[model samples]
Target: MNTDLMINRGIIKYNGNAFEEIDDVIANEYPLTIIVDGDEFATMVCTPDHLDELVIGFLASEGIIRAIEDIAALSINEDRGFAYVELVQKQTMSKDFFSKRFIGSCCGKSRQFYLHNDVKTAKTFMKQIEISVSQCFNLMTKMQEQSTAFQLTGGLHNASLCTKDQVLLSRSDIGRHNALDKIYGYCLKNKLSITDMMIAFSGRISSEVLLKVSKIGVGIVLSKSAPTTLAVNLANDLGITAIGFVRGQSLNVYSHPERIVS
Candidate 1:
């Protein structure tokens, strides 16, 4: 068992009329408090692994920093589950900087952020990128195989940045949003071109998820699960290609089906 990412807990197993006491491995969830330039920012419930990337990604998704260079200094205290980050300029903080909200492992933004923005600020992705239907299935297969954490505990959500051929980066967390943020943060730090990439993840395609992908300027998103009605509408409005229910060789192209080659 990977202790850094999961923990062992005593449990009772029941199979039909048989029962047994045993220890089971479960994904660890910890509250990671992020402090930006000595001010208390927000706390996120996430898997303990990749604290740095989580912080950077969370900030980026919140519109706190635009590039990796914008981060002047960063340090994580695992003992306390806190991340201290300093930005190159204080002006980079969001207009709602002081409004602290407890972000759960499953969701990223607060309800207030969504209510205020109304998806109006989401970038309309105009990139002309086309992928074949076979490529979409292949990418989904790769994402499923690379998600070791989910396979181990069945409690983690996985996300990856991929090209038409392969997955470039992947991350897992208890929250779907955190997983996406980790990938975005990794790309930002490595100076990867997000506009040319697609995001594949193991979760439902919600409007919030679409918003995150749009914020990163990605035009395509693939998911193994279903998509909400609002998410499909948002994808059409944003000019994004959203594919859902990617199982084996089958998938539902909710919006922008023209991008998927036959």
Candidate 2:
């Protein structure tokens, strides 16, 4: 299925004076219901591409699956917009999934408090991957150039896994978290080591974003937008190098500045 559609030609008004008919590419959004071992998991509204990766990534991030081996089988029916994931071990659903929280593109509804021990044990990344400032800027540039969906619809978030010089993988979705999940799923399925990798995102850096990066043991995150105060604090606690507002040749290092060489 196509991820975007050129639905209709419409007259676009500019500057309140001139108008022209233009073909608009609209990004597709749909509800993808995930079923884990016949139990209905959460349904997410996202773009249709990379459904398998999204499912695997979501399960992994939720701590439902500790490793790729935990997933026994996976099937995605795009026609029905459902993903069936069978795990090797039956797991209990997280309480957060059933709580009443307003889920957003960046942060989910619940405000989770992480204990120091919990952060240190499960999510803290202590990798020593140092990237130059120029490399950070260049990685952001590569991510931007690879965001074909965003350029086509101007209504999608892009995320990428990268090294110091090149983007290894990129994914797009209407939700920021979904884009990152797609990348996560891809890496996990391929057994790629994320310890020394960095993530470049075209969205605001939020606490949830930090958690996702931490879950995959990625050491750095770069964003073309701002970082929330809580996100910065979490990055510090998680030992992640968080850089935001990356444009052209400028960026603001929010945490662990030592990771970005001069």
Q: Candidates' TM-scores?
A: 0.88, 0.86
Cα shift from native, residue 121, model 2 (Å): 8.9
Instruction: Point to the candidate with the largest TM-score.
Output: 1
Mind giving the per-residue lDDT tens digits that candidate 2 earns over 1-262?
2544212335575757787667667777888999888988789999888888899888778767767899999998888989998989987645354333433343531224543222322477786789998998899989999887678778889999998889999988999999988998898899987757889999999887887888777889999999998888778877898999999878999999998898
Count of steric clashes across candidates, in order: 1, 0
Instruction: Give me the displacement of residue 93 in model 2, in angstroms.
Output: 4.6
Against the reference, the lDDT scores of all candidates come to 0.82, 0.81
Question: What is every candidate's alpha-carbon RMSD to the true fold?
Answer: 5.2, 5.0
Model 2: clashing residue pairs? none
The numbered model that scores best in lDDT is 1
* Model 1 steric clash pairs: 105-175
